[model samples]
Target chain A: MSGITRDTLMAFVDGHLDPTGRTEVEAFLAANPEVAAEVALLQRQNDAIRTLYAPAGAEPIPVRLSVDRIAHSGRRRNNRFLTQAAAAVVLVGVGLAGGWLLRGNADTPGIADRLIADAVSAHTVYVLEKRHAVEVGGDEEEHLSSWLSNRLQTNLAMPDLTASGLTFLGGRLLPAPDVPGGKAAQLMYEDANGERLTLYITPRPGIDAPRTELASLGADTALFWSDDMLTCTITAPYSADKLEAIASAVFAQLNPSGDGYEI
Target chain B: MADILHEIEDAVPALRRYARALTRDVDRADDLVQDCLERAISRRRLFRPTGQVRPWLFTILVNLYRNSLRGQRRSGDTIDLSSIPEPAVPPAQPGHLALAELARAIDTLPPEQKEALLLVTLEGLAYKEAADILAIPLGTLMSRLGRARATLKTLTGAPAEPHLRTVK
Candidate 1:
């Protein structure tokens, strides 16, 4: 560090020198004329270069540089890789906070994604329970609906999926760590051959996400949609078409009077 | 998530300034900046949570510019320097160099040298940050800057004497 070299001088001229180093270089320049002139020449060059280009930094930035718009484009591109089947029905929900973190925004692993993952994890864990699959079995329909509705703080009426060739097995209250409510209601259903599906419902009070998207997570196909009051993730090992059909029915019974699930 | 976008937004103007100097053409410069923004935003998860965004963005822009140059050359595209009329400038005063001649001299430097020089001088980046963006060692960046300045001094017809003669 004691040696005075050309790089050191250049660093001094460019303000890259630290204080102690600057003093040493200053003393070195005082004892040297040619080296001092070279440093002055370098400083002049820097000034000329700034004069030629710094104005561009002050120019008004183009609208095309909008960060949100660019992030959206990335999400749109990200969606192309989502191999699952259902249409991305816009479910623009209550507030834009959690919902705004949806779709192609998956790469950053947002809160909504964590919710969907938690749904899938819960589904995988409980669907295998033999004697105690649900805390309050589906046998007590009125009790299950009332208890889960109270727990999730949402007006959740079990969808009458009996018309969809499935029986309402039961429902349970689960922890939804990523959502605002901190609780989710999971309803279990099974076809005649015992094919199981779980609907993970959480009251997204401020989640302005009004989107219906189908994503294939491992062996399960998850159809995620949210309206102003509630957000639901339907995860099943069924084909995409089968999930879409069940999702339509669930959406219908979930919100019969309000915003019809848009495709 | 919006925080990352905010950081990227803060870097846009500086990125455009660097691109403009590098390309010496407005449309091309803006095009480069646009490409840089799209790539940065689309893959922002790669951004470190506590890290600064300005150097990361410059790294992306420099890589894209290099790749574009490679693609253009593969197809035999060439830049016609003569058509880029040097901007009008007043005569050089005693110690001053002609600004237009200096600009042309800059245009004539090899891309690597020009990039190193401008990053330090024009963009005012610290040497380490400039080197990191260029993906080169600090010594290599210093050498490039040294050579670029010498070339500019010669091409601008600035007198070459009295340059670092005191030390052997």
Candidate 2:
């Protein structure tokens, strides 16, 4: 407190000073700003470390690190071990009555999961383009709509969402290997800020999974919905509520009959 | 308790960032985090004295990192220094050397000094808690921090405050 040493200067830099000590150091720095500049440099080094790595905190946590999932899996493992031990006891006592029932097959990959993954992968791939973003530009809306509709084997109309701040850029036909028809259409839209969103539409005639399911992948949020004729997935970097509102506008114009468009 | 698990979950991102900055390899940093999480979950029942999970989690992560370094030192596995890309320094910065140059300077610090510097500067840990995490005395922590700052100054070639001194 009384004597200013190298340690005191560092303590000041690290914010280790008590209030009175801080005042003392402040006075010292005010007089000897050469040393103050040194302190500032150390502080800048701290800023550099944070600048380099702090974004990792904002980046979405990978699915493996999900807290709820990890805890649930841990409990499931414990329950499985208990079940096996009970089966062992059953073999010792009840003579293998239901040992075969524990052998269920591995679950099949859900169709909605595949659709969302494909939609996001496709969105991630083509959204970065400056000139080649879409197969048909928005300048030729009638022809682009007909071409995509003809290719997708469904009646496809471009959803105009200018009121929602997203302008139609264009559409591109993409390979949707997960769907029965094996084809999908991507309609690109960009807001005034140049943030892009894509609507992935495929002919999912019979695939029904609650009509709407939302999933988060990295920085993108995907909302997938299906009607009796076509399945539409809207993927964007916007919030879930924003995307939902946009999707509502999209679905209303997408299906003329408008059966399942409100939700 | 589920609350404790939630707290540890909340700390995961910061832990990952700190680990990434320390190791500078994505896979290695994530593997370290996974191991740290698993150990904390298993041994948490033993350290629930005050329910202070943040420092405890940091303690486990720091120890695991040190042990890994010790093992790597014995094994003689080479880290290709050229592989770590330097961050781009935007030209509009006001008064500093290139930020990438500062990054490489930080990389050159001794392991102990680097740990002290990061825990204080990067992680914003209190000096006492940081010392506790490192299992070093408070004075030792200060010395390590002092040495780290000195080395960074030398490597960064920080410009002198000619104007301020002239005013003085």
Candidate 3:
């Protein structure tokens, strides 16, 4: 009775103690009326909590909460055929809109549209590549940066994503017909799990657009931000909030001269 | 593969119960559970053969919950308690007062304590499993559980005063 610790009593009440330990607590409680009452109270509280919420488990789970159903439906929705069909529709729509919008401007595509297109294209191209995804591997990051900057005609810095658990995977140069130089820089990063994310950078398109536009295309979310000199698009399968965190880090590194923007 | 999915599906009910108790809202709880399941399914390849899926899923759920909390903190959105649909139960029964008091006390507990306590008491997880889920040492988990129960006893007007005298 004297040696009964509070933890032993608690484990006894919660049914966590082994039989020998529980018997010791039981003997202690038999001699101590107050300890018995406290144990009883704890039991009642546990019972009350179970009574209040355990019915939720007993209730029929809604169809939407079904994991198999959700996974199956999501897989169906993300199927290559359906995705390609959807992408075709989106591309045709974007092409039509881009044509109309370009007809009005005669010189520049909307920066948001261009960035989204560039992101999806980059994601599709490199996600499929096994051996040569990036022009320069992340191991040659210094050369990757200077090369990308020279190609894009802008001062580009490779944002370190180690804090986000994503390591640099290298970068490449792409055609950005919407930009002044008709070129863009794509920096790729892969997490420890090999989930790849890419950042598409182009010289600023000279359009006064919103500082941030978060858009979802298929399974990927694109977070687009424009500073005075460059517009960067971060495309990943993560949620906007996750992308926001990564984008904030990317922005801090990529735009050393500009005031930090909320990613 | 399918067996793992089936096992995960079986745990969904308990996951929902735990999440509902944690969030106090059905929709939010389901969203948390869904996110947990999706992450678990997608990452099953990374799961070790020796690793049990339940604890791994719980870990994912806890992390997702923390992340959501961080987002909510940044957004500064206030929850309108009135918007939460009340169950069809009538006025307080003999035990309702104690349950309500315990609920408020739980809301007041730090997130770490609440997470640890719920994994043990509410979900009935083993001490080791709860510790693993919370990524804490076994002793730390026990201490948190002890503290949580003691605080609940005091807050729910349990017989702690007399018990403290006897124990000391």
Candidate 4:
């Protein structure tokens, strides 16, 4: 009873005291009506607080607050910043390379050249956008894969570029006036240096197009590869070798049948 | 890595609950939770995989809430305590405290005391754990809780008086 203090009374009310401490407090409270009433009021206050707000924990969580989604978006933002410096250097180098490569083939402007132009153009415009870079974010990969596959009329598996230090930012559907289904899917990816790569994919163009072409134009490199079922133009600021490396990883995943361009 | 995320995910409901109590507004509470989750997940590489995620998350939430309050103060936007919506009344039960009055009193408590009291009472955290989350000594935490409770007791005097004997 001599050990009983205001702190002990509060611990008793909050259920934080040990059993012996609790027994001591209980016996002490039995002897003191005023202190007992105070403890009871504190306990009631705790109950009232819980009653007012505990339902929030039981309510359905909004999707924006999902741990996985926040984690995924956070990764994307970090990727954007980490690569920003390296991407700047690479972009300047590729921009110089891209200028000459496109001029030599401009006279005829074949399907391969046209698709590469569209792919490169899309890449240049979107990579600079801080927001609105993609129609759906990469967190919705499953929905994106299925929706894109349906829209393009071909199976489109979002390639795992994490192996290549690339994070998928997501995809948007675009008009492909030069290809069948008149639709194209642009899948954007970002490297750690904040440099962006875009895959401009369309169902194999009905007219004859080159099986493969590598073109470097103004700060962007476009590597075009076509199989019987689909054509993909990969545009990024990376070198021909780097693009080739990513291309194979993308090719294997995009066309798992293993019949496409052998790296 | 996956384990840490799963741990973080498991703590979301409690984080939301604590945030709800702190902000007393649905959208602001969730926005706070989202910001906390993003920060926790982004900086998780710095977090030891072996540490419990709940206290870490509570620490982040508490810091973010404090920073936001400071930002609002610097911007000269005073929080209108009167603007806090009335709490949803639970059905009356014998010995139930007045919910709205208690909420108002809690809103008016000094931030540190309110935080210490809620961590101990509402979240049911162990006293040490609550103290650690607040980054205060156990003695300091106890004092804050005492002050917070005594203030609440005084503020809710009328509703709580029926059962108490007059000290005189």
How close is every model to the real structure, measured as TM-score? 0.56, 0.53, 0.59, 0.57
Model 2 C-alpha lDDT per residue in residues A1-263, reported as the tens digit of each score: 34877777777777878998899989978887677777777777777777877777777887776766655443211223223323433343322312332232144335665566567667876888889999889999999999988988888889999999998999999887777778999999999999999999999746555465666554677777887788888999986546766876887788766544122
Show where candidate 2 strays beyond 4 Å. A74-263, B49-51, B88-94, B159-168
Native contacts recovered by model 1: 0.55
lDDT of 1 by residue, B91-156 (tens): 354257667678888988989998899899988999999998899999999999989988887788
Candidate 2: residue A236 Cα off by (Å)? 49
Better of 3 and 4 by DockQ: 3
Candidate 3 ranges with C-alpha deviation above 4 Å: A75-263, B80-97, B159-162, B165-168
> Which 10-residue window in model 4 chain B sums to the lowest lDDT?
B159-168
lDDT of 4 by residue, B1-168 (tens): 678889999999999999888888888889889888876765454224344678888988998889888997899987677888776665364265677778888888988998898898889999999998989999999889877887888887644443333322
lDDT of 3 by residue, A1-263 (tens): 57777767767767988889888888877888777877777777677667667777887988877876765553312223323323643565533433444444544545666566666666666866879989899999889888888887777888998999998889888877777888888888988877889998889887676466556667786767787889888888886557766776887788866654111
Considering only the true interface residues, what is the Cα RMSD of candidate 2 after superposition?
A: 14.3
Determine the TM-score of chain B of model 2.
Answer: 0.87
Q: Which of the two candidates, 1 or 2, achieves a greater lDDT against the reference?
A: 1
Cα lDDT tens digits for candidate 4, A1-263: 56777777778888988899988888888988877877777888888888888888898989998988876541322222213322433554434423443443435456776677667656776778879999989999999989999999898889999999999999999877778788999999999889999999999898877566666554566678887889998989876556767887888788777543111
Off by over 4 Å in 4: A74-263, B94-96, B158-168
Model 4 misses residue A197 by how many Å? Answer: 18
Q: What is the C-alpha lDDT of each candidate?
A: 0.75, 0.73, 0.73, 0.77
Best by DockQ: 1
* lDDT per residue as tens, model 2, B1-168: 678788999899988988887888778888788777765654343234253688788877887888899989899975677788766446235346566777678778888888888888878899988898888999999888877777777788875444322332
Order of the predicted models by TM-score, top scorer first? 3, 4, 1, 2
